[model samples]
Target: MRRLLVTGGAGFIGSNFVYFWKKKCPADLVVVLDALTYAGNIANLDAMKNVPGFEFVHGDILDTKLVERIFTDQGIDTLVHFAAESHVDRSIHGPDAFVRTNVTGTLSLLNAAKAAWLDRGSGIPHRFHHVSTDEVYGTLGPDDPPFSEETPYAPNSPYAASKAGSDHLVRAFHKTYGLVTTTSNCSNNYGPFQFPEKLIPLCIANILDGKSLPVYGDGRQIRDWLYVDDHNRGIELILEKGQAGETYNIGGSNECMNIEIVRLICDLTDLRFRERASLSEKFPKALPAAGRASRELISHVRDRAGHDQRYAIDARKIKTALGYHPKESFEAGIQKTVDWYLDHENWWRALMDTLCFSKT
Candidate 1:
């Protein structure tokens, strides 16, 4: 059984991976290292608290000493790294954190993994799986084909650039040092426990609060959405049978415009709470004014700086090579995601209330 060190295990995608691992690889050991930043919450892993062989370390990926200690003490044989400053708007506002965490933090992990796994004479077969994004491939035209594993890196934002740098480091480590590594560049991910800043969750929360649903520009930017669970499954398959030193592109095969996604969320909300009783019972303080549909809350905001026009992934490589496929279509995935946020009102409400009180 493998002893896995999952960095950023408290974040959205990371936490989902932890749960997936528990179900798919229960016999293996999982050691989670997270800094518990604004995006990473300890509560994400609450369900796994009592599970055997699952350990959580409240720490940062930049802490070289702590990382090395875990590598040595836990005898970690697999590294699944998901920690990074991932918000594009935040990166545009302040690029320093993105550079530090996504670039420098990645370098630290690479060094520690190398020393513990390669430098030692124990001769253990280890794997370092680096999770990356398709944004590093840059924007696509309306007629352009989907991005493949061979796409050139042309990151447009600080966040994407930092990730691009990290991807390069992982590749270099494999080429120069012959480290057993596999990287997967996935498309946009949406599911439970996502921080409110992202598009889907933000829209959901805002609609519930009777607040404006801010849409950037025309909101026509296209993105390929991969439900979190599907993405996690793809990663698991890659880790199990994927060839070392190869990169795979994992996508949902579900591409929709931003405006379409927002409208769908609005419709789902309206359908679920068509009655006054349901609306009052759920939101209490944040009900839409009487007779007003949630779609009326849409507000066209200024476009994001250097936003990409479109992104699509050619995931045939993984599909053909590993027989991997996403189970959730956009229709099913969006409804399930909305249902989750609706049912977990207290969970997200606490976070929203804390932020509001802190601001005041």
Candidate 2:
């Protein structure tokens, strides 16, 4: 059986990928290494706790010794790195942790991978796949085209800067030491199991609680949205077939402004609950007062510092190379995501009380 090490496997995209991988490749041995940080909740992996081929280790990627041990003892044939400090607002508050986790931690993993593979001699049959974001391309204007694999690095926020640094390290390792590495830069991802701090989840949670949905600035910042499951599929395809030392961009071709996304969620929620009330033959107390729509909950807040005006990805490379296509539309994906939050209140509620979401 092939052994794979997936870092940050307890977080949003990472966890989703792990779940998909386990089902798609049942014979593969999957080991997950996570720090269990505020954002890394073990609950995300609760369903797979007893799976035969799954293993979980609570640790930080910065721990080189632990990483090396995993690579050595597990005879890991593949590495899918998704660990990083990814929150932009948190990076703004303090960049030290970002640098440590995103920059230094990546270097640590690369060093360990190189050492382990070299010790194993020629034809190690190993591949290292790095997961990254398109924010490293910085912002784009109205007429500017989407970012591609060759886009120059122009990161803005501390979070993006740290990821950019990690991306460079991965490239250098591939060029300098002949490490078999592949990197993927993806657009924004939204779906189930996301912490309630990000834009989509935050909006859903606030609206459900009857709180004002905070929109940064005028809420006009644009981002390309890729469903989490679609992204997971793309990562799996890249890990299986992408050429070493090559970078691929993954996007959904679904671009929408922040305000547009918020409004769509509000309308979906309103319709969903309205129908629920009708079926139950009772007035829905959750609905806003008559004549008041959920859109009234929207309140524009102060803009974040160095907020990227827009982000879009030219995903032609992944599409052409791997024959990958996203299966979910933005409207369908957002409806499912909102309905997920509505049904799984206990999951997010436990996280809010335990994790430091207030800081996020």
Q: Taking the tens digit of each residue's C-alpha lDDT, what string does model 2 give over 1-360?
A: 679999999999989989999899998999999999988989999999889999999999999999999998888989999998898988988899999999999999999999899755746788999999999999999999999988899999999999999999999999999999999999999999998888888877666666787788899999999999999889888988899999999999998999999999888877777656541222233444243578988888788899999999999999999988999998889889988887787888787665343311
TM-score for each of the candidates: 0.96, 0.95
Q: Write the per-residue lDDT of candidate 1 for residues 26-137, one digit (tens) a residue.
A: 9999999999988898888999999999999999899888999999999999999999899888888889999999999999999998988888755889999999999999
Task: List pairs with backbone clashes in candidate 2.
Answer: none
What TM-score does structure 1 among the candidates reach?
Answer: 0.96
CA lDDT of every candidate: 0.90, 0.88
| Highest TM-score scorer | 1
Model 1: lowest-lDDT 10 consecutive positions: 351-360
**Candidate 2 local Cα displacement, residue 128, angstroms:** 0.6
RMSD of 2: 2.3
